[model samples]
Target: MTHVVTESCINCKHTDCVEVCPVDAFHEGPNFLVIDPDVCIDCIACVAECPVAAIYVDSDVPASQRQFLALNAELARDWPVIVRKREPLPDAAHWADVTGKIDHLQHP
Candidate 1:
């Protein structure tokens, strides 16, 4: 299974996890990231690297956030691969803990 990037990463957009992905499965978006299930190795390396705990194994995703599994897959197809770490959004700290952020997702 692939890992999913969920609501905690909405505005945060932390790239710490991207740096740890061995297969380069992470994809960048305007203010978030996603994992390409087709390329993800499921190594679980990126999960612990997420500062906001936004990454989760597909089966472990919170019930409320399960949609992220499909969301990641869908967005990964359109977004560019992010193989290096970058500065997070300016207000990352402000939104890292906020929940119910699906509405804030910026689709590519």
Candidate 2:
């Protein structure tokens, strides 16, 4: 199963997880990241790297965040792959522990 990048990653946009992705399954957006389901190998390498605990196996995605599974797939189709670690958003630390960030998501 593929891993999903959930709403907790919204404003934070941490890239630590991407550095551990063996398949380069991560895609970067303006303020978020997604995992290309087709490219993920289910290695689970990136999950622990997420400081916000935003990554999850598809089957284990929380019911409230299930939409992220499909969202990751959809966004990955157009976003460019991110293969290295980078600085998070300017306000990452402030957003990391905040919940219900779906409304703050920035597409593309």
What TM-score fits each model? 0.97, 0.97
RMSD of 2: 0.8
Task: Please report, in order, the local distance difference test score of every candidate based on alpha carbons.
Answer: 0.91, 0.93
- Report how far residue 47 has shifted in candidate 2, in Å: 0.7
Worst 10 residues of 1 by lDDT: 99-108
Tens digits of per-residue lDDT, candidate 1, 1-108, equal: 878888899999999998888899999999899999999989999988999999898999989998888899999999999999899999999998898888999885
Residue pairs in collision within model 1: none
* Worst 10 contiguous positions by lDDT, candidate 2: 99-108
- The residue pairs that clash in candidate 2, if any, are none
Question: Could you give candidate 2's per-residue lDDT for residues 1-108 as a string of tens digits?
Answer: 889999999989899998888889999998999999999999999998999999999999999999998899999999999998899999999999999889888884
Candidate 1 runs further than 4 Å off: none
Clashes of each: 0, 0
**lDDT value, residue 39 of candidate 2:** 97
TM-score of 1: 0.97
